[model samples]
Structures are given as structure tokens and as C-alpha cells.
Target: MKAVVIGGGIAGLLAARVLTESFDDVVVLERDKLSDEPEYRAGVPQGRHVHGLLVRGGEIMEGLFPGLRDELVRSGAHLMDAGEMRILNPLGWVASGRSGMPLLVVSRPLLETHIRRRVTAKIVDDAHVTGLTFRGSTVDGVLTRDGRIDADLVVDASGRSSKLPAWLAEAGIAVPEPEVVDSRTGYATRLYTAPPEIPVVVAESLSAPDTPRGGIVMRIEGDRVMVTAQGAGGDHPPRDPEGFQQFLDSLRGPIAGMLADAEPVTPVYLFARTASRRIAFEQVTGWPGGLVAIGDAVCVFNPVYGQGMTVAAMAALLFRRHSDFSAKGCRDFQRKVAKTAQGSWVLSSNADQSWAGVEKTPAPLMRAFRWYMKKWQVALVHDQDIFLRFLRVVHLVASPATLMNPVVFRRLAKYSRLDPRPGRRRAARSPR
Candidate 1:
């Protein structure tokens, strides 16, 4: 069978790579003129920001491209044990513990190009897929600007800006209406030089309550560190030199101090239109035969959580699990892929909802639970087990349900009483 993958981003490449293992021919059509070197383009605007390959993605990527982690490390991406990394939550500084998994930090562009180069599929750059060239209802091939190429299947990995839906409608198929959860967020990222000879320290600092700000400092391929400071709900960080530093200083922890001391490399890169969006492709009726969508094309999350590429990579794994890649397979594949994407989707949704000005308020019980969790987050500062469970959930290794278990509740109760609030001093009885 032949497979034509539209869009050569991480998702498309992953789809093509996996398809190659099962199909005779796989062609990837990328709209942008892909560079042999690592660089950003107009198509992928998120490249300018900090991107992380979560521990889950790292495992899948290595399976797809052997020695990928080592190559990434050789190219300059640092591997920091996610549990050992410094994280400042709304509560306080929680001590890092061993989760036996680490995250690979690299520039978004490098990660894409690295995966693209490794895939052996025929990549046609500077090609826009105009539409689909189908016979009756079965998709036989794609309609590119140049001409048509026959294929057994087509995968739409075109990202959140994908035109596949319009192309499908033009082909006389029902276009899927996606559900979106928009949280008007913005980000300002700048590259800085790490102080002389200091090993890169990956740090994430959160801005709580009054300020919905967060930032990440990690060493990428170059000898420089990438620092991204982001604010939600229209609280844009200024591009001016002094204001940027002030924004950093307002963060929860030592990141502001580190940035205050570190030298600047790249100018502050600011990005906006950061919203959580999910395309419910599975709900669409008679979607299409021999065609499927993956990656940000299916779901685009707020970049604040850094799950875009990882979730996309995970989607590829789901796609590969399906034995069939035909028309019925495409629809079935979407339903199956939803299960894999649901975890990260819920993870990001909950975190995004934490900020003020977020439109979608949870139910009364959930709102109360979030308030209680906030207190637990504060209590987690002195509780190692709570901290570990929180990190595990954030990393996607564990579910959000794990945190609500009775054992975790008992631990939190003990910590809350022992380390009472600044003004109050009371001990609550432990749960039986």
C-alpha cells in the first residue's frame, strides 16, 4: 500500500515513519520549504518558544528512531530527570525526587528537523495539498497544486491550521466541527547565556493568583539557554529590555534571579493566540475513506503545558497499533487515537482553567476540589510523597485520579496540620 502524509511537522513525519513500516511507499507533502538545518518558519510559529519532549514522548521517539536520545544530547538537548528538575508550584518549592524518567529539552525546530531527517519517506517540500483526488467515496490519492498522485491512504497532519476539513467538504464529505476551549494566553521567550561553566539547570517557575505568569529555562543545542516567560489572559509580557527582566523577577522562584544574572542572547520573542483547542474528529459522521488526521491537526493545546509534540508523537503510536490503514481504518483510528490524546487534553484543560479570566468554570464540586487541591499544593512543599505524585500526574505517567486516592489524602492531611498556614495553627484529625 502507498501512503501520502500531508504536512511534514512532527506529527506528519511520525505518521510517515510508522506508515513506512507497514506500507510499500510513503510520501510526505510539506507546505514549507524544509531546511536541512534547524530553523523556524512562518508555518510553525511555536518554534520560537521553549519546547520539551516529555518523558513519555522520549520513550516512543527512541522506539521509532533508535539512538534518538543520544543524538539529541549530542546535538545539545539536555536530559534532566523530570523529578530531579527544580519546579516551583503555587504552594512553594517542592523537593525533587526520583521518578526514573527524564525529559529531553531542545528547541522546537531542532526536534522537528531531527525527526524529519530520520524518516526515510519521500518528502516533497513546498507543496500544498490543494484537495483530495478521490474515486466515488474512496480516497485514491491527493490533489496537489502541481498535479495528483495516487495513494492508498492519506494522513492529514497539517496541524491546527489544517485545511483538510475544507478539502474534505470540497470532496463532498462532512467536515468535522471541532470543540475549542480558548484561554487567551500569551508568551514572551528570550534566549540567555548561562553563567560561565555552570551546568544547565532546567527550572520552571509559576506566577500565582495576582499574576498568571510562568517561565522555563533550559539548555538547548547551542551553548545557550532558552528562557520563555508566558502570561495568560492578555497579560502580555513587554518586549522592552527592562520590563522583560521585571516580568521574570515577579515569578515565584530563583528563575528571576538567574535571569537577572545571566546575559541575553536572543531578543525577547513574543507569541500570542495561545488557546487550548480540540478537534472532535471522532464525532464527525462519514468522515472520509482512506484519510486520517493526526497531531495538532486533531488537537492543539495551550503551549504552556508543552504537550503538543509529545501528544502528537503519542498519536503516531496509536495510529501504528491499528492493523488496517484503509478508509474504515481511518475513522476507527481516530476513535482509538482519542483515547491516547484524552489524558494530555484533560491535563492541559485543568491547568489552563486555574487562571483567572478563564471562561469555562467547572462545576461547583470541581471548583471546590480545585480550591482544596490548591491548599494541598501549598502543603506539598513539605510533603515529598505528594510532590512525587503531583509530578507523576503532570508528566502523564500517572493519572489525575492517583492524586485523589485515600493514601494521598491522608498524606496531605498530615502535612497540612503539621505545617499550618502563617496565621492559623490547627491540626485536623486524620481520615480513618
Candidate 2:
């Protein structure tokens, strides 16, 4: 069997790696030459920002490439027990305890390099995949600059700029109507020397309705810390030193002071194209066979939430189960992968809609759910067990059902009397 993968980003590399295990031959075609070192490339615009490998994503990566976690640690990435990290939510300090899962903090480029090294397939660089070449109802191959590369299966792991839907339309297939949710958000990021006093992963502040400003500082590879500040709507972070420090100061408390003291390593970098978009490929009818799409190509989320790469890994793992590297493989794979992405998509989209100035109102259920979640957040800050349960769902290690269990519901009920006024201040001090 022969499998062809387009795009060399995390999703593409992951899918190709899995393909190598099952197919007789696997090839990856990338428009950009991949880097042996950790650096930004044109294909990935958000590479400069902080990226957290959730426990679930880290576990999946370790399963696919054994010893990868240890290798990453040796490479200077921080292996952090999630329990030790401090999170400041709207309610108060979420007490630290064993979270039952661990998170890995590393630069995005380094993580991509690690995956690229694990997948030993034939990589054709500077090869632009122009279109999908189909024969009748099944996809036969892809047309690139060099010509067609026929394959039994073709997976489009291309990132947010993927033109797969248009290519499909050119092949006489109806492109699915994508569910688009836009949150006009921006982020300013920079590298800093970690404070000698701070030793673990810390999420200083997360945006809430009252104060929609958040920032993170974590120990990444090379003993450096990556700090990112995010703002909603058009509330962009300033690039100048004074303005930048004020922007940090605007986010609740303490983190700004801590960051100001940390030595700066890189200039402040700003990025804005943060929107939540999900394509409904599964809902489309008469989809052809032998072609599939994965990763951000299927659903691109707000990067501030950090769901893109982790869910991409989970979706690729789902595709591996349904993949057959045959004529009907693409269609079958899409059907299954769509199911896998639905839960994460809903989780992220709803979260993105919770903010103001997102230009759209949350669904009725989403609005109510957020209201209920806020109450739970207040309770969880005081209850360690409840906090862990909520953290499990937020990290994608567990579903929303876990948040509704009898034990958690009991806690929420007990803490309902402590609910603050609906419009009260939501920001709190750092849990650390």
C-alpha cells in the first residue's frame, strides 16, 4: 500500500508516522523545507508563541514514539507534573494537588522537530500540492509541481490555509458548509529568563467576563520562559516596553510584576488571527472516497486556548483506526475522524464564544453551560477534588460528563451559597 500525506506540520507528520507503520510505502510532500533545528517557518505562523502539550497530547505522542517524553526532557523541555502548577481562575486560587496527568512545556518548533525526526518517510520538500486528482468517485492521487504522485490513500494534514475544500469542489464535490466562529483576539509573546524563584509550570491568569485578559509564564527548553499575553476584541497588547508592562499589569495581579523582573531574551512578538473555525466534513453528502483531511484543516481553534495541536493528535489517532490505504479509505476515514473532532470542536467553540466582542452570541445551551461552569469554577477553587475534575475536562483528558458526576454536582450544590454577584469582579490573584 502507498500513502501520501500533504503538509509537514504536526498533524501531517503524526499521520505520516502512523501510515509508515501500516503502509508498504509512505511519502510526505511539504511546500517548505523542514528545519533540522527549532526555528519558525512560513508554514507555521504561531511557532514563536508559547505552546503547551496537554497531558493527553503528551501521552498520545509518547505512545506513538516511545521514549519521546524522556527525549524531550533531555533536550531541555520541562517535564511538569500538572499538580504543581498554579492556576488563577475567576473564583480564587485552585489549590495544587496531584492532577493524575502531567503536562509538557516546550517550544512549538522543537515539538514539531521531534515529530519530524520520528517519521522516517520519504519527504518531498518544496513540493506544492496544487490539487487532488480524482478518477470518477475515488481520489486517485495528488498533483504537485513535479507532477502527480499516485497513492492508495491521500491525507491532507495541511494547516489553517488548506485549500482542500476548493480542490474538492473543483473535482465536482460539494464542499461542506463550515461552522465558523470568529473571536477577534490577539496575543503578544516573548521569551524571558525564568525567575530563579519560580520552578514549575504556572498559568498566572486566564480571561474571564469581568477581566478578559490572561497571560502565562512557563519554563521551556533551554531554561528559558515563554510569556504570552492575550486580549479580546481589538484590545491589542502594546509592543513598547512601558506599554507592554502596563498590558501585563492590566491582567489581574502579580504576574505582571514577576514578568517585569524576569530578564528578557527576545523582543515582544505580536500575533492576531485568532479565530475558532470548524469545517463540517461529516455532514456533507456524497463525499468521495480515498481522500481525508486532518488537523487544523478540519477544525482550527483559538490558539490562546491551546487546543489545536492536541486535538490534532487525537484526530490523527482516530484516523489510524479507520484508515485502510484503499480507494474508500478517505471517505471512511473522514466519517470516523469527524466524530472524534466533534467533542473537541464543541468544547473549544463554546469556550471561544464566551468572551465579549466575539461578534456572535453563544448558543442557548452554551450560554447556560458557561453560567453553570462559572459557578463550578468558584466551587472548584475551594475544593481540590472538584478542581481536578474540572481540570481533567479542560485539558481534554475527560469529557464534560465527568464534570456532571454526582460527586461534583454535590460539591457545586454545597458551594452555590458562596456565588458572587453575577457581575462581580472575576479576576483573582495567582494561585501560586
Instruction: State the lDDT of candidate 1 residue by residue for 261-330, as single tens digits.
Output: 6788778888886788777778777776787888888888888887887788888877567867656777
Candidate 1, residue 220: CA error in Å?
1.4
Q: Give the Cα error of residue 329 in candidate 1, in Å.
A: 2.5
Q: Which 10-residue window of candidate 1 scores lowest in summed lDDT?
A: 423-432
Task: Write one digit per residue (lDDT tens) for candidate 2, span 329-371.
Answer: 5566776777777777777677667667664656688778887
Error of 1 at 257 (Å): 2.4
The candidate scoring highest on lDDT is 2
lDDT of 2 at 5: 91
C-alpha lDDT of candidate 1 relative to the true structure: 0.76
Tell me each candidate's RMSD, in Å, in order. Answer: 4.6, 2.2
